[model samples]
Each structure stands twice: as structure tokens, then as C-alpha cells.
Target chain A: MQVEGLSINLATIREQCGFAEAVDVCLKHGITAIAPWRDQVAAIGLDEAARIVHSNGLKLTGLCRGGFFPAADALGREKALDDNRRAIDEAAALGADCLVLVVGGLPDGSKDIDRARRMVEEGIAAVLPHARAAQVPLAIEPLHPMYAADRACVNTLGQALDICEALGAGVGVAIDVYHVWWDPDLAKQIARAGRMKAILAHHICDWLVPTKDMLTDRGMMGDGVIDLKGIRGMIEAAGFLGAQEVEIFSADNWWKRPAEEVIATCVERFRSCC
Target chain B: MQVEGLSINLATIREQCGFAEAVDVCLKHGITAIAPWRDQVAAIGLDEAARIVHSNGLKLTGLCRGGFFPAADALGREKALDDNRRAIDEAAALGADCLVLVVGGLPDGSKDIDRARRMVEEGIAAVLPHARAAQVPLAIEPLHPMYAADRACVNTLGQALDICEALGAGVGVAIDVYHVWWDPDLAKQIARAGRMKAILAHHICDWLVPTKDMLTDRGMMGDGVIDLKGIRGMIEAAGFLGAQEVEIFSADNWWKRPAEEVIATCVERFRSCC
Candidate 1:
């Protein structure tokens, strides 16, 4: 039977297959919803990728990403804006629900996070008009604080919501369980996001007790220490009923498995665990 | 000249020297403050440690730590409480300013962070009377979110303050730069902690761009991205003028250096960076 609410982010099977093959695997498992990274869409050519997505009637819950605003200089920042615009355009072309953003972090040799944060706001405002015109929402993914220095300056949902309120429109937040599961004010912030109508996507993954890696060592849903179902309940109560996109960057275990087997496990765990 | 308002957490060079040797190294550099771990103190005997501190008039900013409240069973939890009482007595014997609490994470194999946090509060409340009679304050060190699963559940100063508010007396927080430097509401929360008179200690260390190991790969001050002077300005503005305790858990780098060399570096970095 098709899992109605399950959406597979293409990165889960990116190593096993390319854009076309990953989609076929998801379809075989009856997961019609998917979120694809910009690279995956770019590799197969956006035209063919769009054709496959359209013909199959896939629900693009979100485009994998479109934010990395901080830079060392004006030229570097402009380059970032140019790339974000391209990502926004890709989301628009795919008819994706939103463009997920992993907003950038500190510039090289700089400890001024406050300045970096201001740059993020400025960069978002710069691309927001283009995103709005294309009718693609911007989803700010507040990564875990572990990533605050090198990956994202926006490290909390409340911080992201504050940005959303400041930006006013065409912007919201993506609440990923992996990135935000440890937040002390998670419940309060989820409710606050719902009230602001600022929750754009909900990503799911487990945080391993002995997480072996800082980057690509994500655990499969039921294999780690996250209360996934409880968080989903909070998200649902907060008014987001969108697909629960499974986004895992497990470099060793899942990446080496058969694409079909990984999808099957996700479906099983989503049913039993989440 | 003696370095006033500077303290060395012996763990900075734990791999190099024993407790007495470490204190000797600090004293050689005209450093008069130190925070030693329970194991280090036990290795040298508390009586000798106390005698050394009294002879030299050393300031014990804090006793290393004494909390791991979550356990799978009540017996396990009771065992933890027993250990904590002993830690309190030891801190009292040393006449340390406070007992730092790392607090524990989810009980083994459990995904329930909420339960772990509740256990932390209950454990503190249970131990508050003992700490009070012994005249030792309990400083809740809110660890970085990366350590949330295994080290601490309290990940923000605001959350730490919430627990302090609920617990009422003999409880505060250790604002470590490596842990809380990324908090979006850092300035606001520091001010709030100051208002509550719950700012027990202030620890200093840098957050490296590529933090290698989660537990032991901390950077020395002036070597990473934390805005030390800025944070110090905030702490001072918030009315906290305690020793800027140096706590580095560097396994490969600082740990391998000579004790005197490490102490000298700390002294130089503390004066220049912090």
C-alpha cells in the first residue's frame, strides 16, 4: 500500500541511483512525494528531471536547498546570492512547495557571528523578491547548534521564526528533527511558528547516541535516540500536515545498501516507529 | 605580575600532569586560581589538595562536576544521587565556589530527552539541601547541543535559567564560551541570568571551525571563532566579574604539551585573547 504521508528526499538514495533511478525506486515503494537536491536535479538535466516529476505526478514537498548567504567579501556575498537565485528558479520550475535553505555561517577568519547573521538577513531580503515573483517559498532550515560555526548561523527555530517575522512574506522555516530535536524550547517555538504561519517543511531523522560523524553519519529513523512521533504530533498540532520528508546523509551503512531495501526500511520504520 | 581574574581548569592539560604537578605549574606562572576534577583531587588526596590551596591562597572557581541524574532504573538514579552527595562534600572540603553539573542525557537506550531533563531538575532539587548545608552552590553548565544526547540536556542559558527559577536557591549556570557562544538570545539571556543573580561561573574556550572530536577537541582561547572580549563585555555588563575559567579538553594537541608550556600558553592566551 502507498504511504500517503511519506516523502523520500532523493539524497537518501543518491548514491545508489541517479535522479531517474531514485524516482523509480520511490514509485515502486508507492512514495509519490519527494524532495530533490539541486545537484540531483542538475545532473539528469532539469528538463528531463521536470518531465519525470511531471509525468509521474510527484509531489515536490521541497527543493533540497537554496541558502548560504554569509561570505568574506561583497563579491563573495554576491556570488552566494546568484547561486540562491538559481536554486529558487529550480524550485519554481519543479513546482516544489518550498526551497529549503541551510543558511551559511561565519566568514573565513572571522568571529563576528552577529555580523554574519546580519549578512544572512540581507542576503535573504535580496533573493526574497525573486522567490516571491516565482511563487516559491523560502524555507529557512535552522541547523543544529553543532553546525552553528561552519554550516549555519541560524541555529534555532525561534531564531528562524524571528527572521520570518522580520522578512514578512515569501519566507518561513523548515523544522528538521535531526537539527532541532534537542532544542529546549521546541514545543513553544513550534506553536509560535504555527501561530505565525511560518512552518514550511518538516524533515525527519534520528540522532545517534554515539554519532560517529559531524556531517554524514545520520541514523535511520528507528535506530537512534529521537522521539520522532512526539515531534511529528507537535508539528501536526501546530498545523503542518505536509509530507514528512526522510532526509538522511548516512555515508556508510544506508548508502551502501540497495535502494529498494533502504526505501523499504524507511516505510517500515515510519509505520512502526514514527 | 599575577594574572588576576584568570583560572585554569586542570583538564586543559589533564593528559600531561597529575593534580599537584598541574597546580605547581599554575603557581610557577603566578596563576592563583584553578578548578580540579574529582578524580584529580582523589589521586592526590583531598587533604593534600586543600593544604596546597590554603598554603598558596588559591581561588577554587569551581569543582569540576557532579551530575548524571538520568538512569534506566530507580536504583541507578539513587546511586547517582549518592555519588552527587559525596561530590558536594568534596566541594565543601575544598571550599570551591560551586559544583558544576553536566546533568545527564537520556537513560541508556531511551529516546526520552524530556524524562532526562525532568530527572536533572529533580536530582538538583534533591541535592539542593545537601549543597546548602555544605554552603556550596550548584552551577548548571548548559552544554552545547551536540552533547545533548550524552553530556547534557540543558543546552541554552535561557533553559538553564528556567531550571534555576524553578529550583529557587543554590543553583545557577556556568556560561562556557564554547557551549553557548552561538545562542541567538545569548545577550538577552546573560542579562536575565545576571538579573536573577544566577550567574555562578564563566568558562572560556574557542569553538574551532572544524571541531574534530565532540568531547575532547576543544580549541584554546584566541584560536577559534568565539568572540571572547565581546562575551566578556556582555558578562561584565550583566554584572558577572568572576574568573574566566580556561577549560580545554584537547586530546591530541594541548594534552600532549608539557604542563608548564600549557600553563604558560593559557596565561598568554588569557591575557591576550580574553
Candidate 2:
């Protein structure tokens, strides 16, 4: 009953369980693959988290994040780079497929998105060597345009692929359905990414019709109007045969449910909708 | 002192005033140009609205909207087309520059964005002859990515331009700063639009950092983090010399203000930020 090529990003059950408990829930549901956020790993202590992950023979699809490059000052930028290096190390320790990056947005009190974008590229370049040294590929997750101003300025698969091309190897893209479902150039970009061999990860989540919040009102699969299976087909056709990581950040609804119920819903939705 | 090359989309003060009062406020502030929604026009009666525009020699920058093409059935599609024709007639009656189209998203209970997009294109195509006969150009306003699910599937300038190219003449794009500020391909697409002469309108609004609501949490020009002057410069450079229409949908903030105050602030923002 193992669900091969299916991974659960712990954020889906963030409100219901901690890192260890979330993993246990995933295991019980025959989902051996998982992606954990840095905070989740830190909560359990990275050493214990790594021990548990290793002992369970679980597939670490990806580490939750390692980017926030844009900053108001050079010192802040250096701090972000240092943090990214550490994130790469953590991903390496966990034997993750890649260190996914939610590249930072405009620095506080700044209006120049172009400058922020340049900072993102530079930050990625600065950390590329460290990531490569740790044998961890940096996966740039281009967030939805909604998050471009405050979360991640890298807002398109094409833009992320451009960054990957500029940085050469050791860099690629994390194709998240929630972030990119609206892209008019989606099929073209996926084809381009395939040609460049730059697709690193495929994350899944539904976009609610009435998305209540800008940050955390993510819909679980089958609950919203996303063509989840269609997007997966596109990603698969683009040469990424990796796990489809379910990563919902629903604060009001799904997050309040029990961990077992949440996992069960995810499994059912994965089978039916996705 | 009239602010040249600036227009106010009346939705900015929709919560405070009707069409006639809003027009009076704009005239008082020496902003001769305005774009009113269909509801606002209906409130005052189209004949009165047209008479006011003619008497005051006011410039109707563009009509608020005329698209929501996707439907659950053929009857819905036909109804949408008929409505679009009416919108075109209204725009022509007002002597507006174009009929702005906020192309509809997925049909109810459906996850097929591609089909929705096709419906939009087909809907526009169906209405093109009527628009042409009415002497009203159709301006496809690519809404923000957040609205792609329920409001609009066309979410980028390039995508809008593609539709324009396919549809031939009497069709173009409304480059809204709020919707497209985050697009990395913006400059390239604007330049491409210019080459094709597909740039019909330039809408302006700030994207607040913490956008509270997906539909109505738009920010005023200087209050938010958008590079208004920067984007305006891009559009101007791309040969679009139309009025920079201020279109904010701030339900909690600006909407609560006096209509005159909102118009005055829009004038000030246009001079300073834009």
C-alpha cells in the first residue's frame, strides 16, 4: 500500500503535529517521502530529526527552504547567504534531493523590485558554491506573483529558469502548483525547463476560489479548483519524476484537523483529484 | 492645474459616490478623464452619464469591464457574449477609449483553466465584430495572478498581447500596474506590445505589502510598495501614451474616505509617485 512518488511537506499538518509526529503520520499512511521545513527540523533538534529520518528509510524529497536573499543592507545580505549555507548543510545532512529556496522579496521600505531581484541572483550565486560543496542542489521555488512583493520576488518558472541558466550547475527550479497554476506560459516554461534539465522539485496544493488570506489560506487538493493531475502530468512530461510534495498552509480549515485525518484526506485527494 | 495624462477609475471611490458625483469630484479636481463601472453608469442612467460627459467635455479613459467569458453551459456563454456587446455599446455611447475586458476565470465547479482561457478568447472573438461596428476597441485587462481562478484567467501582459495578435485589429491590452508589477518579463512584453501596437490602456494602483483581501485590498499609489513611476516610464517608453488610470479597490481603507478626498489623493499621487 506504499504510495510511491508521493511526499508530504510537513506544513500541510503544521497545525496538527510537530516534525516527529508529522513523519509518524506520513509513515502510517504509507507515504515514506517527506519534505520538512527548517523550523520543523530545528524544533526536534536537527540531530534527532536526522536520526529519525535515517532510521526510517524515508525519502527526503526536499528541505523546506534556504533563501531570502534580498535585504536592506549588505550586512543583512551576508547574513542571508550564511543562513542559506547552513540550510544547504542541513539538507545535505538529511540527504535531501535538493535545498528548496523561496528567494527573498523587496527589502523593507524599498520599491526597487529589480534591485531585489538582482540581490536574489547574487545571493544564490554567493551560496551556490557552498550548496555544491555539500552535494546539495539549490532548488529555486518561484512563488506566486501574490508573494512577489513581500515573500519571494522570483515569481515565475521562466524567471527561475533564467537564474538557473545564469548560475550554471548546482541550481534548478522547484515547480509548485499553487505558485504557478495561473501562469499563461506554464506549458512553454515547463518545456523550456525540461530542455534545460532544470526542474528540481514538484510541489502540490490547491488554490481556493475565495483565497481568504494572502499568506496562509492554501487549499488542500480536491477542495479547490486547481487541475492538480494536469499540472503533475506537465511536470512529469518535463522529465521530473520526483515526488509530488503536498504543501498546504491552510490556517483556518485543514490545519485544525487531526494529523491522521489530514493525512488520510491528503491520500484520498491524491488518489481522486491529483 | 490639470494633471495631464492621468485618469481615475471610479472604483477608487465606489464606496463613497455614484457616477455623477464621482465625475463632479474629478471635474472639481481638474482631472478631466475617468473610467466608470457599468453599475455606476446604470445608477445615474446611461443617457444622463453620456449627457454629463458631453456637456463637461470629459474624457472617458475606458469602460470598467466587459468580460467574464467562461460559463458552465452554452447558454451562459451566449449570455456573456450578449452582455459584452452591450458593454461595447455602452463604451461607444460614452465615447470611451476602449471597453476593458476582465476575462473570466474557470467556470463554476470546474478546474480547467485552459478551457476557461479558450472561452475568454472565443468570447472576445465573438464580440469583436460588434465592438468594431460600435467603434469601440476591446482592451483585455490581464488581472493579477491571484484573480486567475475566479476573476480572470488572463494574468499577464504577454498573454493579453498574444490574444490581441491572434484576434487582429480592434483588440489590445490594458497594462495594469497592480496586476503585472511582479512580472519579470514585463519590460520585454511591453516592448513587444509596443511593436505590435497592442497597448491600449495603462492602469495604476499600488500592491500593499500585506494585501489583506484578494479582491479589494488594493493600496493607494504612495502608500504601497509598487514602483509606479518606474512602471509608467516603461509603458511610456513602449509607445503607450494613454492616461495612467488609477484603479484601486481598497474596501477597508480608501473606500471609507470621502469621494472628493480620494480623487484629490489620486491627483496628488499621479503627480508625485506616477
Candidate 3:
């Protein structure tokens, strides 16, 4: 019953259960691998969270996030860098495989994406040493283009690779199907990431046709329009045999369901669709 | 005073007025160029709409759309091709510069984006001879990636240009800033588009920070995070001197405002921001 090469990013059941309870549900369903958000870890206190994770002998696929470097002023930018350093420390303590970073988008009242991108590069460079010292690899998760204004400006695999190349060894990419399934250059970029050995994580979810909400409303594995097997094939070809982390942020449907049902469904979908 | 080199895509005020009224407002504001949707033309009858345009010598920047090729079955695909041929004829009748194609996304119940993209290319190729005979160019509008699932699978300038190159002449690209702004390779691709003379239309709209709705939360030119002047400079540098067509789909905000105010703001933003 062990679901080989599969991990549940706890955000899928964040609304239904806390960190400890979500882990219990995952364990019940034979899912020993997981990725947890910073807030989720903080809620249970990092020490207790680490203790539970260690005692259960669970595989920590990745830590939820740490990036949003663009800011309007010097002080704001410095604050973001400081926060990312703390996240690096947390990832190290948890023994997570990598620290996923959703690089921030445009600053307030700013139309200059190029400048914001430059700020992102600078912020990452500033934190690289600390992340390396903590033995945590930084995974830049390029968001969908729709989130380019408010969520994350890094919106392409190639772009993320470019940053990885610039930042050198400590940085890599988190390839999420929800954000990148439509990319025409997906095959080429995955190959590039593989050549550079920059693919750190693989995230899975389907893109609903009538995506009712931009931030949420993500479909479960087999329910929508993503070629999960095809993307996984690409990732596997790229030499990443890591867990396919399920990270659905559904507000109306999945979030309202019981935590047990959600985990059960994830296990079923992982076996059947993914 | 006339806002030089500016065009209004009538969808900006589609909720407030019909073809004649929208035209009247545009003319009153000294705007000589406009792009009207097929529905707006059909609502007032194409003959009347054509008559109005001829009487006032209005410049039809580009027809408001014609593409959605992916279909569940052969019948649907054939119907889409037939409809595109009609759209080409209509664009020719209106003396529009080109028939803009929002090339359709994945067929219903399928997750094969590559197949959907092929359908789009074939659909365009099928209609090319007719478009050439009618003396109307086909402009493939690369919609934002956010629309890749249900609207259009062709979501990047490079992808659109690849289709153009493969299909040969009488085909080009419509460079909408709202769609292409987040592309890291935008400048390079715009330059590539220029060298190939593939730039047919330049649509302008701001990307709001907190985009409330995926399909309709488009912001006005100066109101969001897009660098209008910067993108315009790139397009102009790429040898596209056509009017910067303002197209916004703001259902909750701008659509609720008075038609005159919306047009006035468009003109103002067109002057200052773009």
C-alpha cells in the first residue's frame, strides 16, 4: 500500500487539518512523504513539528516557501531577505530536501517588472551563502503568468534556470504542472534543467477549464486538463526521480471536505491518475 | 483633441453600448480607429455596421476575434474551420487589417495541449487560402497563459511565431502587452517578430495586482502593474507603428462605469501611460 514516489504538500488539506493531524491522515493512508508550509510548521512550533517528523521517520520532500524579494524600498527589500534567511534556517532544522521559493512579483505601485526581477536576483544572491551554510537547496517555483503582477514574477522554467545559472549551485527549480503545463518550450526547458541538474522538486495538480478562482480552485489529479503522466515522464527523463508532490489550493470544493477523505482521495488519485 | 495613434477595442465599453453608440462615443472623442467584436457587429447587423464605418471613415484596427479550433469531435473541428472562414470574410468586408485569432485551447474532456495546438495551426492553415483570396491577413493573438485551458492554447509570442513560420505568409502575430508582458523573452521575441514582420496588432491593457476574476479583471492602461510605455517602445522599435488598441475586460469595475468616462480614461491613459 505504500504509494511509491508520491508526496502530499500539506496545503491540500491545510484548511481541514493542522500540521500534526494532516500528518496522521497521510500516515494512515500510507503516505510517508510530505511537504509542509512555513505557517503550518510555525503553528505547531518547529521543535514539536521536527520531533514528530523525525519520530515518524517521514521523508520531508520540501519546505513550503521562502521568496518574495521584490519591495519598494531598501528597508523593505532587506526585510524580505531577512525573512528568507529565517526560512532557510527552518528548512535546515526540518531536514527538508529543499526550500521552495515563490519569487515575488512587482512591488507596490510599480510597473517595472524588469527592475523587480533584478531585485529578486539580488535578494537571492544575498541569501545564497546562508542557504548553502544551512545545507538547504533553494528551489525557485516559477508561478503562472497570471500571478506575475502580485504573486511571483518568475513565470517560466527557462527564466528560473537563468536565475539558477546566475546564482550557481545552491539554486534550482520546482516544476509545477499547474503553473507550467501550457509552456510550449516545456520539453526543452526540462532538458535544460536536467543538463544543469537544476530541477529540485516536482509538483502535481490539474488545471480546471473554468478556473473559477485564480488563487484557488485547482482540480484534483484526474478531474481536469493536465497530462500528469506526460509531465511526470518529462521530469523522470530529466533525472528527477523524486516524489510528485500534490499541492491543490481548492477553496470551494476540496478545502471543505474532511481531511481523511481528502487524503484518501489523494492516495486513490496518486495510484490511478498520476 | 484627437489622441494620436490610439485605437479603442469596443469591448472596453461593451456592457454600456451597442455598435452605433460605441462608434458615436469614439467619434465624439475624436478617436478614428476601433476594433469591434463579432457580436457587436451582428447585434446591429453587419451591413449597418459597415455602413457606419464607411460613412465616418473609421479605421478598423483589427476584428475582435476568430479562433477556438479545438473541439470534441470532427464535426466540431469542421464547424470551427467553417466559422473562421466566415470571420475572414467579415474582416474583409469591414476592411479590417487582419482577422485576429484567439486560437482555441484543449478540446473538451482532453488534456492534450499539443494536440489542441496542432488543431489551431491546421485551422489557421485551412483558412489561409480563403484569407489570402479575400485580401485579409490572419493575426494570431497569443492570449495570456491564464487562458491556455479554455480560451487559447497558443499563449506566447514565440509559440505564435513558430506557427506563422511553419504555415508561411499571410499570417502574423497580434502583440498584446497584457498577454506578453510577463514573458522573460518578450523583448527578444518582439525583436524576432519584427525581423520576420510578424507584428500585426498591438493590444494594450494593464494587469491588475489583485486580479479578482481570471476572465474579466483586466485593468486600465495606467491603473495596474504593466509597463505600457516600455512595451510600446519595444513594439514601435520592432517596426509596428499601428495604433495601440486599448482592450480591457473589467466586468466588476470599468464595465460598471459610464461609457463616456471609460472612453475618456482610456484616451487619457493612452496619452500619458502609453
Candidate 4:
């Protein structure tokens, strides 16, 4: 009873399970594809994690993640690049589809987002050679504008596409529903991403009204206002029928639930809502 | 000295004082321009509010606000239009430059934002005749993307401008720095807004990092990451020499302060930062 086209990003269950248990839950529920964060992989040991993923014949939709490109100084940026190179190596080992990037925002006490954006581009360019060499595609995840000051400065799919166009190759975009569902130009940009062949991953989570917390209050598929099926249809039309990776970061609600229950709910919601 | 080009949106001191006291405080500080919410005006009684403004020769930058078009049924929509018509009359009475529109979000149990946006446009179109007769312009204030679901579906200047272009004369936009400072196309859109002569109001408030509350925690002009002077430069270059209205919605901080202190601070900040 393999769910034909669904994937679970491990962050959806990060509080309840680690890398290995998450995979086990996904497998138990017929979800064979998973995306795991770097810390989770590191905690379980990359070699052991890779062995488990391979032995189970699991699809690693993406490795989450590697991009905090902006830094206050050149030395700090070099550190970030070195870490990203390590992440690429890990992605290569896991045979993950792509390395998802949450590109950094403003440096300490600086108001210059343009400079921060430039830094993100340059950081990605610096790592392009290594990522390409590792056969890993870099997927820039454009975060919502609310996170513009503290998190990813890359805040739109079109902006991400512009970056991808600037850098020759080995770069793409991860279309996350929570970050981009409200975009007026969503269909146009998703289509543009399709034409550019840059839609490396698709992530799902609803945007709850009265979104209680700015960062950790993501909703499950059907509980909020996002037109999940509609967006999935758009993505499918755009030529990427990849798994819709579920990534929820709900602190007060979903995170408190048992891992099994969470996975079960994800499966149910995916079938019924998403 | 009278601060040459500054306006006070009364919401900044909403928690501390009501309409008349707020106006007195503004006049005492030499800020003769103000934007008052309908509730504030109703509390003071519109006739008295109008008298105060007339006697003091105050400029009504805008009346805050009108537009909540999306409703669950036809009756609800008609009610919204009726309310918007009343708001138009109030703006006319106050000699306000425009009636700001915080266009409504999706209706209850409905995730159809396109329908909601269409409702907003239709609502505006329905009210345009009344607004024109009353001699009050309509200023569509494009809210931040975070408010797209509950507060406003119109989340970008470009989107608002598109509506204005479609609606034709007596319709424009209120460019709030807090709402639109993060836009990658902000400069270009502001320029476009200027080209169309659609820039009606320029609201100033910094976007604080770690914005504690999405609705109320806006920063002062010099406090946050928004390039206030730069944005002001853009607005001015776009031929909008109108007052830069101070509109901070700080629940725990600014609202708790005395009205005098807030007005004084606004005057000082408008000179130094904005």
C-alpha cells in the first residue's frame, strides 16, 4: 500500500523522533520517501543514516538543509561555505535529490538586505563548484517575507529564479507552500520555475490565520487557509510530479503529539486534504 | 517649530487616548495632519471631530479605513458595501485625502483568495460612485503578506496598483513602509506607482526584527532594519512630497506611553530618521 506520491520532511516530527525512527514511521505507513535535516543525520551518524536509507530503499527527496550565506565578515562566510561543502558531501552520501538552502538574512546590526542578498548569491556561487562536483543540486528555499530580517533574505520564487539564472547551473528552487502560498504571482513563478527546470522540491504546510507564532505555528495540510490541492495541481502542471514533502513546525500543537499519531494524521490529511 | 511634513495616524496612541485628546496632543506638537480610524471618530462624535479639524485647519491625510469585501453571503457583502459607503461619507466630512482600504481576506470556511480579491475589487467599484460624489479618493493600503488571510488579501503594491489601474481615477494606494519594505521589487513598484500617479499616502514605521506581535509590534523610524530615509527618498523621487504619516501599532510599548511623548518622538524621528 505505498502512497504513490507523498514524502515526509522529518522536521514535521522532529520533536518526537530522530532520523532513524522517523524513517521507520514513514516506512511503516507506506511513505517511502523522506527528507531529513543535517543535524538529525549528524546525530545518528551519517554512515549509519545512509546505510539505513539505502538498505530500506528509501527516496531521499532532499537533505535539509544548507544555506546561511550572509555573515558579518568574510571569515564567517568562509565558515558557512565550508559547512555547506560538508553538507554537500553528506547529501552525496545519502543520495538525496538536492540540498535545500535556507539562505541567511541580515548581518548583525546591519539594515542592508541588498548586501545580504548579494552575499547569499556569492555564497551559493562559491559552493556551486563543490555541489556540482558532488552531483548535488542546490535548492534555494525562498522563505516568507516575515522572516526577511532574521531568516532567509531570499523571499520570493522569482527572486530565487533570478539568482538561479545569474549562477550558470547546479542551482534550483524548493517550492514550499507555507512560505509562498499567498504570493500573487505564485502560478506564474511556479511555471517559470518549471520552464527553468529549477523546481527541485515541493514542500507542504498550511498558513494558519491568526498565525499564533511567526516561526513555529505552521498548520497541517487542510486545517488552514492554503489551497493545497490547487497548488499541487499547479506544481503537477509545471512538470514536477515529485512527492509533496510535508514540513510542519508547529510548536504548541503538532509537535506535542506522538510520532505515530503525527504520521498517521499526515497520511490521512494527505489522502483527504492535500 | 511645526514639523514641516509629518502626519500622525491615531492608532499609534490608540491605547493611551481617544479621538479629541489625541487631536489635541497632535496639535500641541505641531503635527496638524492626522488619520483617524472610524471607531475613534465615532467615539468623539463626527460633528465635533469635524469642528476641531476645521477650527485647527488640520489636514486629514486619510481616514482609516474601509474595505472588508469578502463575506460568506450576499447580505454580508451588501452590508460591507453599505459600511464602506458610510466610511466614504465620514472621510468626506473630515476632508481626508483618501479613504484607506484594508481589503478583506477569504470568507469563513473558504480558501478561495481569488474570490476574496474579486470581492474586494467589486466592493471598491460599488463604492467608487459614492466616493466620487462625496469628493473622497480611495487609497488601497496593501498590507503585508502575513495579513493576507485575515486582514487583507491585497498584499503587494503591484497588486494594489493593478486594482487602481483597473478602477481608474479617484483610486490610488497608501504605501506603508512596514507593509512593503521587504518587497524585492519595492523600488520598481514605487516608481511604477508614481508613474501612474497612484501614490496617495506614505505611512512610515520600521519593521522590527523578532516582531513579537504581528499586529502591534511595529518599530519607530530609526529602530528597525527598514531603510527609512532610502524609502522616503524613493517616495520623494517618485514625486510624493506629501506628509509621511507615522503609524506604529505597538501594543505593549508605544500604545502604553503618553500621547504627548509619542507625538514628540514622532516629530523628532521624522526629522532625524525618516
**Tens-digit lDDT track for model 2 on B211-246?**
888888998899889988888888889898989999
Which candidate number maximizes DockQ? 3
**Regions of model 1 farther than 4 Å from truth:** none
Clashes of each: 0, 0, 0, 0
User: Interface RMSD value for candidate 4, one decimal?
Assistant: 0.8
Give lDDT: candidate 3, residue A52: 90
Please write out the lDDT profile of model 2 over residues A1-274, one tens digit for every residue.
Answer: 8998789999899888899999999999999999999999999999999999999999988998989999999999999999999999999999999999999899999999999999999999999989889899999999999899888999999899999999999999999999998888899999999999998889998888788888888998988888888888888898988889999898888888898998998899888888
Candidate 4 local lDDT, B1-274, one digit each (tens) = 6777899999999998889899889988888899999999999899999998899999999999999989999999999999999999999999999999999899999898888899999999999999999989999999999999999999999999999999999999999999998899999999999999989999998988889988989998898999899999999999999999999999888988888888899998888998
In model 1, the clashing pairs are: none
Please state the interface RMSD for every predicted structure, separated by commas: 0.9, 0.8, 0.7, 0.8
Off by over 4 Å in 3: none
Query: How much is the lDDT of residue A190 in candidate 4?
Result: 95
Docking quality (DockQ) for each candidate = 0.81, 0.87, 0.90, 0.75
Minimum summed lDDT over a 10-residue window in model 4 chain B is located at B251-260
- lDDT (C-alpha) at residue B163 in model 3: 95
RMSD in Å for candidate 3, one decimal?
Answer: 1.1
Residue A104 displacement (Å), model 3: 0.7
Question: lDDT scores for all predictions?
Answer: 0.93, 0.91, 0.93, 0.93
DockQ, 0 to 1 scale, candidate 2: 0.87
Candidate 4 local distance difference test against the native = 0.93
